[model samples]
Target: MHKKFMYICFMSNSKLYKGSLTTIILKLLNENDKMYGYEITQKVKALTKGQLKITEGALYPALHKLEAEGLLSVEVKKVDNRLRKYYKITENGEKETTNKLDELAEYIKTMQALVNPKLA
Candidate 1:
């Protein structure tokens, strides 16, 4: 029973992180002009105190998808003989971020109301 409960908790947390990946990336770019993949992953882990972590496998795919979608622009830089891709938000990305955030906020409020009717 305990193992099942733990597994469910882990899955739930992973789903939340996956759902927020786009928002996380956009918000990070919004705060800074640009950031490399590793930096973005570390920032999210630090900001969430390790509660939220982005696996490279998942992060790269999302970044690539965002780039393909025209929401992100990338610049490559050489550091220590290795190339790093730094991402920044485009103008359209900035506008989209604002709209998405508002929608997420409303969704959160509605969920909270459902969870705790008195709080709403």
Candidate 2:
């Protein structure tokens, strides 16, 4: 039963990602000057009260993809005797983030109307 529940949760999260993971990541970076990979995952989990978790398996790839697209800039810094890579939004990333946020808002509004239509 626990496995079943976990599977259901995975399915739902998978659907969420199908729509908004990239936009969500961009939004986070837009709010902050810079963030590291692990920091991003922990911040997201805390903000969502553990409802949403971005595993490293998924997150690193997304970060790499964003960096490749020139939407994110990467910097490596030495922290606690180890190198940590941080990501910051570029000028293009800021513009892209704004556009993506607008698109996501429209999507949410559409979903709300479909899920609970209001009588006019």
Candidate 3:
């Protein structure tokens, strides 16, 4: 019973975080200029009160895809005998972030209307 409950919670939380992954990454980079993988993950967890957790598998692919699309740029740095890749939003990324945020806000408003028609 406990395992099943845990699984359900995990799935629900994953859904929420997955939808906001791009927004989260963009906002983080916008605030900090750049961040490494672990830093980004930790920041999201902390800021969201552990509600939003980013897995390595999900994060790396998203970061790589963003880099490939020229929305983000990366810098590799040596830290404590290991190389860490830090990501920063490019100019295109900054503009894209604004657009995405606007679209997301509109989506939320639409969802709210569907959920509670009187509120719309």
Query: Which candidate achieves the best lDDT against the true structure?
Result: 2
For 63-119, candidate 1 gives per-residue lDDT tens digits of 999999999999999999988999999998898789879878998999899999999
Candidate 3, pairs of clashing residues: none
Give model 1's TM-score versus the native structure. 0.85
Candidate 3 per-residue C-alpha lDDT over 1-120 given as tens digits, one digit per residue, 9 for 90 to 100? 356445322313334445677877887887799999989888887887977677766788889988898989999999999889999999999998998889789989999999999989
lDDT of 2 at 19: 53
Residue 92's C-alpha lDDT in candidate 2?
97
Tens digits of lDDT, candidate 2, 1-120? 356445322213456667567887899999999999989988888888877877666788999999999999999999999889999999999999999999988888888888889821
Off by over 4 Å in 2: 1-14
Steric clash count of candidate 3: 0
lDDT of each: 0.83, 0.84, 0.81
Better of 1 and 2 by lDDT: 2
Q: How does candidate 3 fare on TM-score?
A: 0.85
Residue 34 of model 2 has an lDDT of: 98
